[model samples]
Target: MVRKCSVAGCNNTAGLHSFPADLKIRRQWLHALGLEDREFPPRAGVCKLHFTRDCFSNAMQVEMGFSSQLMLKSDAVPYANVTPPARTPRPQRRPGASTSSACIQLPLSRDVSCQTDPLETHTVGTQLSLKTLLPHFRSEGVQANVSCKDFGVGMSNADPLGLSSTPVKRPRLDLDEQLEDDALEHSSLEEALKGQDSTHDPASLDSSLKSADSSTPTHNSKKYIVYESCIMELFNVCPVCTRACDVRTQRLGTFLSVKQWCPRCTFTRHWNSQPVIGSVPSGNLHLSAAVYLSGASFILIEKVFKAMKLQLFRYETFQRHARAFIEPAVIHHWKATQDVNLQSLSQEEKVIVGGDMRADSPAHSAKYGSYATMDLRTNTVVDIQLVQSNEVGGSCHMEKEGLKRSLALLESRGINLDCIVTDRHPQVQKFLRERNITHYYDVWHMAKGISKKLEAISKQKDCEKLKKWMKSIINHIYWTAASSTSEPERIAKWTTILNHVRDVHTHEDPLYPKCEHVIRKTTDKSKWLQADTLAFYKLEKLLTKKRTLKDVAKLSPHHQTSSLEAFRAVILRFAPKNVVFPFIGMLCRLYLAAMHYNENVDRPLAETEEGVPLFKISFPKSRKEECRVKPQKTQPTFGYVADTMDLIFEKVFVNPVPYTDALLAIPVPEDLSP
Candidate 1:
């Protein structure tokens, strides 16, 4: 039978000499690679050598000299240069046996020359190597299988190649050799395991992992993270000082609570006892003078928070803590000015100062209101005090004391006064006269006096009309007094109205006994009179009769007590309505707000180059000099609030008095407790 050529496209029968008859495995490879024989033209069969060269060249070209197609073979063997048939055997020699054309037999070695030598004995210097054994075995006609196919049982009939040769049995192992082999194998296995552990160093590895775990946080660790906040780390250590001194204390802690104390320093400052003011603000706070100078009302405070975008805090808590922070600065600034005395000022310059007072409800210790004095020209508040008085005496006593205190402050500052103008309060009058200071009544206050009297004479509703009419008369009276041209005219007009009011009120069922008494006692001798001149009377009547002048004068400049009222407004602003901490915080806020106001006086105003309108203050040319002189006594120009503890404490004792029930009874709604 003819089998097709394994090469592609050839019809010639494949001969045993080229591909060999036992090529079942080779055929499978060819088929899988799509390399089976194809039809070649008639008489166009390729010889084995040419076919091999072409295949080698094609493989070389495909891979560009990557793997060589050159086959290797032993030089001494026939067909060594060609692919050998499977199951071929290689020749080998048997132990202690030799083969020859005559016979095969085992031969005794030369070392066993002695007849007593045992069969197992051999010379110690002699050993057989595998290479020597192969050559000797080949000479004995014994062959070894070289290819994997030699182990198969089937034999190929077409090719004289097969691996059915019987394998000789090796010698059986002895007991000692078997035991030694087991020991060597166990030792080798143990050494291998130990070597692996040495390379890895499990102990050091475990320690390294443990140390690494300790230094860093695990993914699930919990932290009390304060959002958008920064904290300044401060050391608690301080220099030793045995002597006690007042100081405000603050603590560095995980939470806002203050607990520990350092007894060594013995320094206690006002502690911020309030709760946390919410989260830390995200950005830096930069407040302007305008904001500082504004009233310290809760509204303004809230506005400041809004401007900064700080998270809002509880209103009460915010007020408490904010006041604590701001108050000290205020007191520091105010106290700094106390050393400057007004008396040292030139008389020609005159420290034209005004005094005023208002009540603070949250303050527990002071019954009388807080007092303030300002230099009218400078508009700066020079001094302030809290006066205490019994609810008893009257507003009159409070006024007297406040005036005295205001004058004392000027004297302490060494400022000298030339003249004073105020409402006609008896206490203010007495104080001014005693000091021999020239005094003029505040026209606005005088107008109020008239209105107050008329109001007493009418119903609560009719007081508005009475107030309007009285203001007109007060304005005309002042005009007559200021510009009458003659004392007789001023006196005639003043007395004529006084007599008319007295006569009209005497017969009627009166509402105001004091008003009736005041009218009946009218005289040219009083200071309310400009002069005893006749022309004053005619001018007063003519001016009073005119509707335009009356209207103008009625609303006239008499109400210009804006300076004193401004002082009250400032206190209200800095001291919120709901504060409950004995009103001490209020004082602090007040002081700070005032200082802020003064500092901002130099700010440029849009309307003018002269800068903002502020209370006038002048420092001496010798700016290097520190103010240390004692102040001189002076009279205050503004009328003080009447007959309260302010008079006794401020005027008589020159100290703050204990609070009375009357002052406490006055409702103050804005006090916030922290």
Candidate 2:
């Protein structure tokens, strides 16, 4: 039987609301219905027509067409006028006709009677009731909650719910098998609920149901290189009318759109492959940002896309994105990171940093020079300053200007420097002296300069014997710097090279009176540099050079700028010298490289499965054909790329005006061409 409004005048049954369980609310509802004098029947309800529009809690949603159901607010009472209809008497049951034995009563606020033949099972409303009853049945006894009596049949309690009391006779399965079955059932129920929930859109329900039926995992939201043919398959037939559709596809860089119209049923649909942020497609913006952050060349990536017949944005579009969003994010992130680093450094008594400048090209022809400073203790790039040749008056002076800018930045952050290590450039030395800053020469830089002179001398006729001692001389420079604690000790150890090459271990200097190595008789006399020979004379003069001695005395006893050199190599990946970039573009790329270096510089070396340290043999060009073993480090991660992407999408994309303003504030130099 259909439910009707409990109000006497109303016969309407749709959109009915059950009376609230609270006694006071129920009494008020009955009073409004003019039935307070009579006893209210259990499970009685009032049609929505009797309630005013203000009674609905979702009144706005209903009015805006977002919802079809009218939900009454709590404490709401029916006050709308009801017109009385002709009264009809209840139907009388025929004699000898018994109620259906399979009838089941539902546990609802309003009574809903269901009946069926005893031989046929009634499945309607069973699943919903079981969902509500399963927990109670599990906690208590299932037999006590559901039984033959609930099916309108009286039976003994021993055979409750008409289920067999004895356990199954089949052999028990393994624990894994039981768990697998339980997991499958749990997942099935979860999928069923996801599909059946009314709040979910039909498109989502369809996708969820399809996922439940498939064995493979979904990758709809992940990045993929999809083919045009594969995408066309989805639009071949209209989903609404199940007929042939005239589908049109449009492409804008990495963005794609599809429109389908069915000729038979006039069905139409439009879809885009990527979300749009303002006027730009999100995919296009992300691609441009990723390319810049990962130190990838856009031209190379575009070529790859072209070879694969894939769609991609133009270089101009990439530059536009960089200027508008990616560049500002880099500047913002770098400054924020630098501020934190500086604050941390400020707590220390004295910070020893290694500073260096890298030119975009060799010699005076270079257009740009970037100065990078690293905290020696942590081996992290703390700050980088980019200088254009034009700003510094000449390419030769860019390095000095870049270093000055970096020092100024560090000074502004209140970081106190105990000492700094750099190459012995005359301009740099003079500048540091004027400021009274304690400066030392990087051992590698001094050693490299000495090695070049020795290499050239060894190439001359009769000076070929010097080649045998070149490697030993370079190694001695590092040893002298590493072993000595003072200028006297460093000079004494360094001068020992001249005596040691002539098969002499005794030295005149009291700081290093004798060689530290064990005395041994030489089996191959040819290896030793004999006194008074041309090779020996050239080696002594070069080793005893006034400038060389001065640089050796100030060799950095602590950290060197090798890591800074490594950072310059990293910059090559971001801003290659072969490719020209605008001033801001070069600065942003330098920032990106610095971030990448700072994040991964201290990564641990890779290890084998047995916990043994791993190493790889490499033949470096500088080492000639000789192979050297180096530790194989763990894979470098691009976490900074993700951070940059987040910054762009969450902050920059939302309100780019502030970020653009910051980018615009940077002074970009005039183009060289015109």
Candidate 3:
């Protein structure tokens, strides 16, 4: 049956709103219609003509074509131009002739008022009884037959006072209750409909519907690797007719669409395995993002997919996605996070940071160099600058250029640097000196350099004894930097390593006159280098080299850049040197690596249920088969990936112009080829 407005004179059947179950709001609505004193039908509703436009929640959306329906606000009440219909006057009684036998008939369209006592007589026109009117009411689909004896009114079954002692049938007033039950039963269908828009394309509509489905409280969103055969089984049979269906399947990369039609019942359905954004499926975009963000090689992933006969998008498609959405998201999120970190550091009086440059390739053949500057206090990467080799004129000069850009950015952001620790790069030293910034050399970089030189000398025929003290010499470099507070003390302590390696343990310098270790007799007599021998002479010359000593004097007394080195290793995972990338692609990958590193830098060591720290044993190539025990860190979280995904789908995908503009503002260097 069609629904009409609850107001008595109005017969409009469109744009109606149901009566709210809330008694207070319902009373207000009834009062507005001048029916507050009567028992209105529960199924009655008010049309939109009786409500003002401001009462709708989506009035603007509907007007602007963004929405096709008008949704009323929860507290809305109809109050516009509503008037109650005038009641018809009752006919005069015939001088009260047998009034006790008279009966009243109420119209089905109007409210009916019933009395508590069934034996009471209601008079209208003639001397008509309720028993005579009951047959007509039953014929009109109104169940109102009642017997006075059934109500315990002391009436006899022998038709006393013309009343019968039969069962009563009351009118149903459960229309609103049944509607509520139906709404509850089909709530999921309502949710699905709410996500659809007639104005959107099928792909976007699918995306919206999928998003809505995943947002439901019962939905547990997870990704699974499904095979084609497994999916085909679901559409092989028709759900309506329980017969075979003509199923047509289409595959685009990781996206699948199935169309099924049943010949018997003419039932059909078109289903999409995953939502899409524009022509690109969400799975395809997400897969590209996951590989890039996690530093996994797409080619390797493609191989895995091929091995399993799984369809995947091409490399060009992945590149397209990266250039359009993934890269911009990475850049946007990194800059946002970096600003927060720098702002926090700017509040401090003195900020000490470690700076380092990592090349895309080893030696001078590198095409890209990324300089990462980290706040030593927190061990979090504060900034990253990617420099193309051609932009700096050559690969060798990219380090200085990257450093210049990073320091310039930090300075503009008001980061007051007390000092910076870095590898002993001559250009970096000169640049910092020119700027009057205090610069210290990382002890590890200096030790690694000295160890390489000593290792080379130990391989010589006459200087073979230097091999015995190589480890001790490297350890002394770290001890000297850690123990000494001044440059003179550091140099003094470092020179004593020469004496300690030989039979002598005393030094001529007053700052460090003797070895700190307890005096003990040597177990291996041939291990100690004798004074004036060729091996001792070579070792002494290398140790006291003028430049080496100069580097030693500036060894960092506090924080080191080992964390920065680890971040470079992370960069390898995202943008490896073996695979070439464009300027923006490389830069974005660097940002992704930095984000990953900063998020997990402070992860605590993994521990067992008994609170014992865990460790992993690895045989590094450099260790020559000797196993090194390293602390096992707790599993890292990919919250940044989730955040970036949200940014891409919710913000960037909605309006990509701004993110693309921000990306385009960066000065990309010309291609090196031409």
Whole-model Cα lDDT of every candidate shown, in order: 0.36, 0.69, 0.70
Ordered by lDDT, highest first, the candidates read: 3, 2, 1
**Candidate 2 residue-wise lDDT at 455:** 94
Q: Over the full model, what C-alpha lDDT does candidate 3 score relative to the true structure?
A: 0.70
> Candidate 1: TM-score?
0.35
- Give the Å shift of residue 160 in candidate 2: 61
Residue pairs in collision within model 2:
none
Clashing pairs in 3: none
Taking all chains together, each candidate's TM-score versus the true structure is: 0.35, 0.68, 0.68
- Candidate 1: deviation at residue 474, Å? 3.8
Task: List the candidate 3 regions with Cα displacement exceeding 4 Å.
Answer: 1-220, 237-244, 277-279
Best by lDDT: 3
The deviation in Å at residue 439 for candidate 2 is 0.9
Candidate 1 lDDT over residue span 1-674, tens digit each: 44544344444454312332335643443344344445322232222322322232122211211111222111111121333222213345456544431121122322111123212322111111112212232211112321111111111121211112332132111111111133332353222112111133222222211112243211112323332222111113211222222222222122221111123322111111221111111010012112232433555657766786543434443343233222333343356444442433534356565666665553344344666665566556666665444532443366567677777766665566866555566667678878898665555555555555554543454223333345446655566455433334444434445433323433221222222235444464322423244333433454345442332322222223456665566566556555533445445455554454444333442332365433334454333354434232222211111111123212221211222222333334333322
- For candidate 2, which ten residues in a row score worst on lDDT? 171-180
Q: Tens-digit lDDT track for model 2 on 415-436? A: 9999999998889999999999
Off by over 4 Å in 1: 1-325, 337-349, 361-368, 390-396, 452-471, 484-560, 576-583, 592-674
